[model samples]
Target: MSYSKQKNKIRLNLVIALIVISLFSISAGAKTLTDLADRKLSLPDKIERIVAIGPGALRMVVYLEAENMVVGVEEFEKRNQQRPYIIAHPELTKLPVIGPQFGGDAELIAAQNPDLIISSYLSQAEMNNLQAKTSIPVISINDGSPGSMTEAELKMALKFLAEILNKNDRAEELINIFDQHKNELKSRTSNLDLGMNVYIGGIGNKGAQGITSTEANYPPFEYLGLNNIIEDDKKSNFTISKERLLLENPELIFIDQGGIELVEQDLKREEFKYLKAYQENEIYQLLPYNHYTTNFATMLANSYFIAETLYPEAFKMLEAKEKANQIYKQFVGQPVYSEMAEIFGGFKKMKLN
Candidate 1:
């Protein structure tokens, strides 16, 4: 071959190489995102399809206004239950179950060919393991554990999701709603001379617990500046015996919807007859906070309801369900108050004779 011919061929090959590099650059514009576990992930710029695992992962996605992008859901959410969001977004139940609860099926997840995975309530190890097993970038969210409700943690998760989903405006709006209402609650109750010893029962941790189950630092009680009758432990859910109930004789009582049946059963017992709250038919019902993991909207709604129950004069104009729907609209982009009201008879006074 002549030198001129060889040089021409070399120039053509160089041009081809340059085009390949440019094409590669166009495809490598993927960015890195940090999950709630603080793990760094390299992800594609456009995330159109998603699968969420762990506890309440889908719920968090729904709050982000990205539930339509979800390609799969956990089996638990697929069940025909009355969780507010579940009822609002019935189409989600039709999707394939990624796995039962937190135990994800990697094969199923990969089959969906999701661009991203959102896993809630998972440790760093479990998150990384799932990410590796499925070869999909996973974002972990912390929305508190079983019966523990932490606003700061939930805010962090919301902000993190907003960043990933590019929904900063919506995130800010939701955050503002949370802060504004929480401040309202604090301002209303901060300096009050609280004397009414309030007792909350039927607090569900794992599932529908008995009436004896309760929490030490119940969020709504803490917000309302009222004294929770049981201050013995700092645990989330612990059963205080009926004997203790008789000894304390709390001024007011509230039951979680999850354990309403158990509460009614306990009310039938002669042992509970002497309790002042029950005897006066002063038992009120509140939404279940732990069902399908912490429903942040319900938690805030219940807080408002508790505040009203504690100080009727202040919240006389504000109906609890109305306030709850406002919170729900801000958080989930819809007025879900009616569904919640239908679900377990939300935040109503129990009038059993």
Candidate 2:
């Protein structure tokens, strides 16, 4: 072979080798994340822009103080202003709408050009399908149901998302605050044997319902060791019949402000006046904690208010509204208790004539 030809062949081989190394480097840069669905995903090392889909997904992102990274949101989030996270970060609503609700529109999500997509309560197949459709790395985290999510499950989700967003310190801070509040609540009322039967009505399931709508095992009652009139093994929201409510006849009644108006309308009937709670004027109003999904911070605030109401001596030092604002600030980066109170009536007693 001619000397010039041999040199050209060597140059070509070097160029090919360099291309292979570059390809390997690019592959090595990606990190593998094992999502809650138990699916393995190769995500970009630096995820700058993201989109959160499904119920409680965006809320979790906001909890981790990573809302700035979100480039788009579900259409419902823009329309609904009840959620504390959304209320705290109104700018999120201004972002591009990805889709209507629940799972987002794949084409719209793709158009946002996000580096990653975070989802909640989605099955493995669904996450895989979304990733395939959008050609974006998708990670699923389980946030269980609102008001029913275990603390461990919530912490796991927060830590996972925090790790992904490089907000580990924030995760720790949140977890600690949650623990402190839970412990304080338990300690306050653990020994109290509140024999009086209590009931919370006007609980919103899908939309607002009347006084018949309630939770079988209300979390605030469980936290405060108060006796909830309704008892079931399954901790879920369901409507009870008026006849059954009359039979149970709780001594103390608490109405969820979400359905307070409906509850008040129901009270106009003389039959409701026969109940012990009505006769003694024991009915009180509580802020709605189940807006959108679980307003976890609001739930905690509700627990404080419930405790203060049931055993005033136990919580004499505590100011319910002030405590609520502090909790709202810790969870959502803003004190949203006043805004929430204004939307749904603030904590107070119901006037039953």
Candidate 3:
């Protein structure tokens, strides 16, 4: 071939190469996707910088053992600054606090350099605003409901956490353990005569209001195969009066943190001590601090304590300490065996009279 002809062929090849490169760049740009929550999101192969916007989401990160990757946390971090685990990580405590969905410093969030943001139950508008403010991806998960969120939701969230953190194995393992334990609990309680008189009592001195039988409190009662005895409160996070509570006389009373304090003070009055729950000793306190904080291990611990107490004969094989450690390793990725041992050290074993 002549030299001029060879040069022309080379020019044609170069033009084609440039066109292909341009197309590839456009395709990559097209992939900038948004999720159901509408937070600007891109599913990059890995996540290194994470921002958790809700207390529940933050707790999930702690459980998933991805605390190191967290770049920022919301206002709750400030409230929990003095909390032992959080205090140990001074950097997290020092990070700037952001407001909730209603209002937050969007510019401040962009400056933090996050690769992804996790939220729980955020409205579409709030999500869109965050996406607009940052180039990072945002994913949202639903908190478990009294009976609404099934195992599927847990696995779905786990898969999302795993994929985002690049720890698929750990997520699968954690999910499997929960499923296994739940099934075991069901089998054990299948035959028990779990009374339907369930009551949620707060520790306030003035006598806390009761949840109407319709409301769902937590997973323990449901997981243990016990029937919900309390009537549902029409509104969420409601308060009840003493007159209504006396009428229900629930067989089982589960107290949130500070609940027992109220009980202790109120029951001291001669008239209050005479109530059936007080007299029958059906009341039990939900362990403090950990209950509201969003840690899966804590939830599991709560579940075990409630189930084991209510059906001691069936859960004879359960070693609460060992189970707690399994959850810690599966999610927290840290062996909290000794630390948790202290936390659960004083649990009073339930005695069925």
Candidate 4:
């Protein structure tokens, strides 16, 4: 071979080696993350398409302003129009359905061609099975209990999701907003003992129930340091018998609008009309915060309304609708208060006839 030809051949081999190295680097571009389920997953460095499965999974994505990257949604999410998040982003309903509620159909999820699958409230084994079936990275997240606005678990979940979606700034901003609301609520009602007996009824458990459905340690009541009639060691939701409710006989009764119809029907009974709240017309309605899971923003807004209602002089300047609109806008990028109010009668005193 000529000397110049030999030199050209060596240069060509060197260029070929560099090309191979570049390809290898591209194939290995992934980051390991520990999800809320404590599963270690290697995900692509830049994830452009994702599908959220289970309750509150898609809401986290929407919270981070990464909804645009969602490729598909659960059938339940598409059908449930009552949630504030869905009301704000109706386009999500237009996305292809991955499957039914809770966990999605693996085949349908894989068909979406998503780079990542976000699973909430799924066990590790379920997540592993999903990932294995779809050949996609699955990250499980927990959003704490439904209707809790200030739980640490929720904050951590948001941070973890924000990290994966490159939305750290948004996560911090949201966290700050939540903290501000918490502080404001605490400050507003920290002092002054009204010694008022309160009860929140018509809470949704598996689904909507009548006026007997109630939550122990209800978040809004706890936030404002109000005295809840139902006391339990563990925060929970359950139904109380009409006799048990009469025994407690709380001074003020707040109904969750989700089950307002059922509650209204219950009030028609002669037995319920004997309650102190019924006779004094101290019943009111609060926007429902639990749909698929907790709508943190709505829950927070409820606290303000409750405070304003119980201690009007303290919150005299706080306009309930305006404050609710601000909170909804911050969380979902839309002023959804009007829509929510339209669907579930806005904050108002209930007239038991």
Best by TM-score: 4
Residues 1-353 of candidate 3 have per-residue lDDT tens digits of: 34795688457545533432332211353334333243334556545887777435665666566788887666667664433345335567676766542234567677788777777556666666777777655676553232223344555555656555766676656766776666566667767887557755542222232222123454666667665554453432345665666666666666643344445565566655555766777766544333233344555665776777777777778866566566556555544655543543323422323
Q: Which tens-of-lDDT digit does each residue in 119-186 have in candidate 1?
A: 87777777778888988887776622444546656666666676667776776677677767876887
Q: Tell me which of candidates 1 and 4 scores higher on lDDT.
A: 4
Candidate 2 residue 162 Cα shift, in angstroms, is 1.5
Worst 10 contiguous positions by lDDT, candidate 2: 17-26
Q: Could you give candidate 4's per-residue lDDT for residues 190-276 as a string of tens digits?
A: 786878799999987667879988888787887788767987756677788889999999899999998999999999999899899
- lDDT: the better of candidates 1 and 2: 2
TM-score of 4: 0.89
What's the lDDT for all of these models? 0.77, 0.83, 0.55, 0.83
lDDT of 1: 0.77
Query: What clash pairs does model 1 have?
Result: none
**Clashing residue pairs found in predicted model 4:** none
What is the Å distance of residue 312 in model 4 from its true position? 0.8
Q: Ranking under TM-score, best-scoring first?
A: 4, 2, 1, 3
TM-score (C-alpha) between model 2 and the true structure:
0.87
lDDT of 2 by residue, 14-133 (tens): 553343233222347776766666676788889999999987789889999999999999999998878889999999999999997777989999999999999876767777898999
Residue pairs in clash, model 2: none
The best-first sequence of candidates by lDDT reads: 2, 4, 1, 3
Per-residue error (Å), model 3, residue 184: 2.0
In model 4, where do residues sit more than 4 Å from their true spots? 1-28, 143-150
